[model samples]
Target: MANSPSSKKRARQAERRTEVNKARRSRIRTFLRKVEEAITGGDQAAAAEALKSAQPEVMRGVTKGVLHKNTASRKISRLSSRVKAMGA
Candidate 1:
């Protein structure tokens, strides 16, 4: 469908971006999952450490445009709260 030269170039760029973004999203999810598993496992110390490590990864996802700022904030907030509650 992209007949023009610029359109073709754009299509190619989009394809590459999609691949990169997919990997970024997967990486972020992996970090989040680790935090979740630690929390659910009732290991307060491990959950706290996991969340501490994942926090920057989530923020990096925001900076790299893989995640929205507000979305990352909400996730971090909720995860921290759950981790905190685990201590109580």
Candidate 2:
């Protein structure tokens, strides 16, 4: 489908990028799942720790272009709020 040499190179680059992004997304989801499990288990300390660990990972996703800044922020906000509410 890529006729031009530059277009072929660009297509190859996109394929590589897609693979990397897919791996990053899976890793981010794993971190988020840990946080969710901790929250669901009602362990405030563990949830706090999980949140602390996950926050950076989520932010890194934004920085690395796997996720939008606002999207990551919103997820962090919601997860933190849920963790906080677990105290009640």
Candidate 3:
């Protein structure tokens, strides 16, 4: 469907970017899952640590255009709240 050379090149680039973004998203999810597992296991310290570690990764995702800033902020807020509640 890409008749123009530029369009064909763009299609190719999109395919490659899709793979990269998918991998990045998957890695972000894995980090989030670690925090979730820590929280679910009732380990406040581990959950806090995981949240700390995940914060930068999530923010980096936003900076890299892999995620929205508000979305990342919401996730961080919720996770930290859950971690805080775990201590109480």
**What are the candidates' C-alpha RMSDs?**
0.5, 0.8, 0.5
Report lDDT (CA) for all predictions.
0.97, 0.96, 0.95
Clashing pairs in 1: none
User: Which 10-residue span in candidate 2 carries the lowest summed lDDT?
Assistant: 36-45
Evaluation by lDDT, superior candidate among 2 and 3 = 2
- lDDT of candidate 2 vs native? 0.96
For model 3 the local lDDT of residue 15 reads 99
Candidate 3 ranges beyond 4 A from true positions: none
TM-score of each: 0.98, 0.96, 0.97
Q: Give lDDT tens digits, candidate 2, residues 1-88.
A: 9999999999999999999999999999999999999998989999999999999999999999999999999999999999999999
| Candidate with the larger lDDT of 1 and 3 | 1
Q: What range of 10 consecutive residues in model 1 has the weakest lDDT sum?
A: 23-32
Q: Report lDDT (Cα) of residue 48, candidate 3.
A: 92
TM-score of candidate 3 relative to the true fold: 0.97
For residues 5-71, write the lDDT of model 3, one tens digit per residue.
Answer: 9999999999999999999999999999999999999899999999999999999999989999999
